[model samples]
Target chain A: MMLWSVVLIPAIAGIAAMLPPMRAVRRSLLVATAVAHCGLVGWVCFATPVVSRDSWFAIDAPARIILAITSVLFLAAALYCVGYLRREEGRTTCDAEEGFLFHNEPEGIFVGCLLLFLASMSFVCICQHFGLLWVAVEATTLASAPLISFHRHHRSLEATWKYLLICSVGIAMALLGIFFLASAGRGHAPGLTLSGLVSSAAAMDPVWLKAAFILLLVGYGTKMGLAPMHTWLPDAHSEAPSVVSALLSGALLNCAFLGLLRGHTVLAAAGLGSFSGELLVLLGVFSMVLAAVFMIRQTDYKRMLAYSSIEHMGILAVGAGLGGVAATGAMLHAMNHSAVKGMLFLAAGNLLAVYRSKNTCDVQGVLEKLPVTGCLWFAGFLAITGSPPFGLFVSELTILKGALDGSHWVVAALYLAALGTAFVAMARIFLPMAYRLPDGSPHDGASSPGAREPVWSVLPPLALALAALVLGVYVPAPLWDAMRQAASALGVL
Target chain B: MEVVSDILVVLLLLSNLYLLAASRITACIQTVALQAVVLGVIALTSAAGGLTLVVVSVTLATMAVKGLVLPWLLRRAIRGADVAREVEPFVGFTTSVLVGAGLLVISVVVAEPLCSSAPADVSAMMIPTSLFTILTGLFIVVTRRKALNQALGYLVLENGVYVFGSSLAIEEPFLVELGILLDVFVAVFVMGIIIFQINREFDHIDTDKLSVLKD
Candidate 1:
């Protein structure tokens, strides 16, 4: 009961946020629900793992970790949304005709869908049944579609279309994998359940299991944004609102990772863990190499961050692939990457507000022009490039060490070399963009029209950055214990 | 009775090939509709007395929704878009046909060993038809440029899975079936809405022109 309360409190708040009539009230409901959601997560942090099931739902340590991450991320984004809507309200001059696709209008539908998206992602993390998981994940795609297409421009439409189509095909393929898995379980009565299948995996046909695992990887890999299947990610992330981008990058990716982790667990229980681990490693390395090559030439700052996401997700997969201590490292890296990337993306949004473009070339005198946002963006750039002392830097080093200890020296070296290249590439463009003084002089800059600070916008990422730093340095004993328990359940450490 | 099942397998195989070789979008839709009707008939006829009859009823419904309603909807959408022929596909029709042939051969090779583990009542042809359907789905998804076509391709692929699973006498969880159907409905509906807006904004539905959105 206590475990379920952690998610349900926010879920109720989210639905309430959608029902309120006034825009201001809706925003408050969203923020208040977010606060309560975070509070629930705090409670779950101290609570015991509570399981409730009649052959269906289970609330174990693994699901609790997923619930905690989803709740926390959604809560933070929801708090940030209060400021986003405030900014939006100031800009939109209500006109009926140009609202849905073109206007900077505060749409009722957008607000509703956004909350629904949060609820759906939460549903995905907690659901134990494969059917429930699939439904929730696909529901996330549909609920979040409007958010991705918030601007309603031709380009946004294109992105939403691609995101929807590719992910659907991938998930549909996942269904086939599930079907084949069930087919392999001929003697068992009925359908799929994680625990039941694991208990009886020895008798299951190996060929079908192998086929199901491959389909599962490729199917869910589409959402995980693994290479060759990740064409939709950069587009959707770049085109969406920075807050939405934060959720997509920080939160949505984890839901997919959860699915993959579950698949890996099934394989491990079936004594086929080694084969799946090898495939994860190969895909992870391939993705990192691809990101490194592309990030060097990426002209759009937002898209660069998108590529960086690809890089970090690859690292998580690699850690999962290595198993043992590496799996623990992967678990930490997943949380760290989401927290750090969420901060970076939100900070980048603030930068976008000041510069009014995602292009690297156009903006000048950023630090002087919008000091709060500029500094945050600069710090974000350092943080995500795996700079020293930041949480990401710590997590990456941990993963590298784990990889080396696992006797995968080649992966460790590649990890270091790739991070170095990323730092150099990111710093090359970010520094000049931050420090270059506008030619018009500092006096005129102080008197420039429009709100220069983005103070509301800067705070969320700033708070997120601090959290990332603190976690990198010292994770609390309980969280660390929880992580270990989750990893053990995943069959790695 | 067994002969009808064998003939149904042949039709399913031929449909996969037709889908692969299809340059005219309408023909592809019609072929898929026919495949759906056959699938529905197969579902009704072959109820291998297993765990529950609910699953069989669901399969029959899936045949109706996936095979019938979906193709009809796609056909109407193609008419609305005026994209009757997806000519000059990314992969030409002939090469796709050859690839489909190769997939069929591989599927046969793969299904032989698989049949040993399959239910005794399950026809051997189920594997090849499913394989062909899966390959054909992948082919249409990759080769076609329009978003709507890819959505249809997704349905064809799923239908193949339904046909594949029926032979195993495995009972699909009801919630999963309902969820999958709802997912398909929303997915196709969303795709249709997106394409209409794309057409409205850009005046054409060629996905290549959307490349202006790069980093």
Candidate 2:
């Protein structure tokens, strides 16, 4: 009943939101559904594992962690959306890309898609069947594509088109991978459930197994924003509304990561752990290096955050690749990254609303303009870059310790170098945006005179930042157990 | 039955080759529809237990969506966008056809080892045919400049995956199969709407000009 409610409530609410013309009702429905979903996930996490009778669905360890992260992130994003919609109501902005005026998509459709996005992501977390997982992942792409182009401009549309094409094709590859997996286990007839695959994995053909893993990695990696396949991410992230960007970074990427982890579990059970691990670590390192290279001298702050997401996803790949304590670290990092990045993107949204520009050079003196957002934005930068007294720092340290424990000196070195570079690059942009004095030169209207930080925007991220700070100083016992269980489940322990 | 499956596999291969050289967007959409219809029949002929209710329903669903509905959507999209042909492809037609042949060879090489261990009831050429179609679909997506054409390529790619999936004797739930079909239908439907918007906004559906948001 609990598992069914968690998925069904959001879907039902999504449909409900589409029907009602009342803005207040829709907004409240969004928040109310998010709260219920988050509460259910919290309860499920603390309780015993829940598996369906036929083993088609289960809230296993990894599912618990991902569900918790996605739900919490969704709640925060939902709260932020209420305020965002309130501010955006009846406003038409001329898109700079084509200098054309357009109204945003209807509020009802936007809210509907948001709830559906939540439902699809929750579905991704709970699905034990590989085929259903593919459906859920693909559904996420379809749900969010409209949200990406909320502004209905050339740039956003272009971003939407690329996102749709790339992810659809990439996920199509994953479908093929699933078929290969089915073929690999043809004689065993273990079915497509994760449990079945893992238990009978040893008898499966190794060649097809390897092919399945590669296809799953490349396919989901495209959605997870890993390097070489991460080309569509920055555009979509920067172009979408900030609330949507927050959800995409903090929630959606983790869902895709969850998909990859499922495949990794099967491969590890098949005794091919090291093969997949090496590939993950290599991809992780490459994403970090590429993000660091792009982050330096970056112009757009939103795009910079997008690259940061790619880098952190790399960190996650590295942590999972190292296994043992590192896999635990990766799980922890997934939580920390989601919280901190969600807060950061929300803060960036606040900045965009007040300053009306995404280019770093265009907006300055955030401290003088919006003091609350500036401070949170600055703290978010530090937290994201793995600075001390933050959740990310703790997770990064855990991953580094895991690398050292595994005697992977070269990986450790590259990981440190990438972190340092990203920190410096982000500092160069974030410091000035937060603290630098605005040049006294007059230019075309950029900063709105009446723009001020709203309680809605400030409160949600404030709660997230507090959560990150709390995690850094002390890891909760339940979460720690959950992370370890997730790691062990992946065969890393 | 084996001969029919073999001929269907050959037809799948022929459709892939035709897509590589086809310049007209409408013609490309038609070719994909033909391939999808062929794959639906292949699903029927290649089933291990002859033909059951489950097999027939799945085949009909595949045919209705892939053969009829999706191509219709693409046709409407091209009509709305006024995009008649895939002119000035990133890779020329001659070169892409040559590449398609190479991809076919690669698919055979890749699938040869797996074919030996595949179930006896399944067509011997099933794996290679699916792989080749998949490669060609990807090829078309990459080399084409038109947004509508890229969408067509995606549909073709999905059709290839369907062929491969149906060839496997796994008993996936009926709901899951329907869910997959619904997803593809929605994907193409969404793509068509976006193509219409793109045409209205940009005056052309050329994806190359969507270079505004990079690095």
Candidate 3:
């Protein structure tokens, strides 16, 4: 019942959003639903007896955590969307508008798909059936297509095309990988459930297990935006509307990472964990290095954030691969990264709205121009760069400590080096552009220029950033229990 | 016995070379279709048990979808768009083919050692052929200029993926195949709308010229 609430509330509001009603009312409805969903996710994860109905569907602690995070972020974003649309409609009157991105919001295809994407993610997290997991993951691909092309422009179209092609190919490879996984079940219980496979691991064929893990890693890693396989992250994230970016960065990566983790779990049961971990660590380092290289020269702020997302995802993968306390850090970082990054993106949206441009060179001194927003932006910058007093700061520090504790000195050093480089590069942009005022810039959308801190826009990020601070010092018991359960479920100690 | 199937497998690899080397969009489409037919034949011959009617039908369906219908649709789109040759290959055709050949050799060499424990009844050359097809699809994607042609490249790439999926001996491949088809249809449908939009906005469907949207 509670799991249904978590999935159902948004589903209902998403439908309501499609109806011709008061936009504010629609937004309020979404917010109400989201808050309700968060409460229910709390129950399902910590209080409820792990929502499992047969092998087809379930929402365990990890899935519950992800669902709760996405719900909260979605609610915050929905609130921001209400304001963004008013401003957008204001601009829509000026620019020669093509058409609405969707037909009547009541039709609910777009928002319904968003809800469906959420439900499918929950399904992916808990569905014990391997085949269902594949379908659920593929469902996310379909659900997100329209979201990626939300702006419905030419570039959005191109990005959608690239995303579909690359991921479709990747998913198809995953299907092949699934075939290997299935075939590995031959001469055993003949089912692909985790427990079933684990019990029979000693009897399973080594040849097929190795093959399956590789294909699974490549296939799902593509979805997770692992380096050398991360081409789609930038275009998809940047081209989508900012709220969608919040979801993609905050929620989608974890779901895909879970897919890889599932495969790694099977391999670990087969006593071949080291092989996959090595591959994962290599890709993780490569992704971090790639992101750091690209971040320094990137002019588009949205793309820069996209690269940062890749870097964080890389860090998570490396932590998981490093094992022990590092893996624990990865799990904590997942939650913290989602929260801080969600705030940063929403704030970026507010900044972009005022600046009327995405070019970092074009937009500067956010702090002076819009003091409240500027402060939040700077704070988000600090939080994301892993400075103290933020949750991400604690998570990354623990990851480094874990690396050293595990006697992986070289890896620890490399991780530190990458972290420092990313921080410097991000600061190079946020420090001056956010802190220092360039000549002849609008301070606020008022007597000086077309800029002012819209109340609708300002409040969500302020609230979220504050929440990030609160969580950094003290995560609620339910969330901590949820994280622990989720971590344990992933076969982590 | 292995000799004949081995020859067909080698042809599949060569078809990838043809796809990468070919400058003409029509030829790329045809080579991909040809490769699909070859893969279908491989699947048919490689079946351990006597060809079940189910296997027969699957092979025929693979031939129909990947070989005949898809290529035909792509050809119509190509003629409709009036795209003849992809002039600005992202990498030169010769170089792309050479690199593809190198990749093929590497695939066989790398995958050969990995799957050594498997029985010879499963085709040894299957993985290499499929890998080359994957690369070939990627080449067509990067090298092509027109939206329709790029889409064709994408279609071939998908067919390549389908070939790989088929080779993996997926038990419920029919379901997976249907999933693949659904994905392909949605992808192409969306691409068609995009092309139409491109035609409306730019008066042509050349993706290279549709470069106004970049940062």
Best by DockQ: 2
Top model by TM-score, which number? 2
Model 1 captures what fraction of native contacts? 0.68
Question: DockQ values for all predictions?
Answer: 0.60, 0.84, 0.26
lDDT of 3 by residue, A1-493 (tens): 5545655565566666666664546556655666666666656666664433234356655566666676677667767776865665432222112333332112234455566566566656665656666766776776677777655456677777667666766776776677677778766735666666766766788878888888888888898999989998898888777877888888888888878877877777777777777777889888998898889878888888999999999998998787666776787888888888888888888877777677788778677678888898899899989997988887898788878887888787778888889999999888887866666655454544435888888898888888778878887776566566665655645
Report the Cα lDDT for residue B22, model 1. Answer: 73
lDDT of model 1, residue B199: 72
Cα lDDT, model 3, residue A444: 57
Q: List native contact recovery per candidate, as a fraction of 1.
A: 0.68, 0.85, 0.24
Worst 10 contiguous positions by lDDT, candidate 1 chain A: A92-101
Residue pairs in clash, model 1: none
In order, the Cα lDDT scores of the candidates are 0.75, 0.89, 0.71
Best by lDDT: 2
Q: Which parts of model 2 have CA positions greater than 4 angstroms off?
A: A20-24, A52-54, A96-99, A441-451
Tens-digit lDDT track of model 2 for B1-215:
67887889899999999999887878888999999899888777777666889878987988999889989987777674545455558998899989998998999998888788666777788889898989888988898888988998999899888888776655567778888999999999999989988888888999999898886
lDDT of 3 by residue, B63-112 (tens): 77777876776665544454445545767878987888787777777666
TM-score of chain B of each: 0.87, 0.95, 0.83
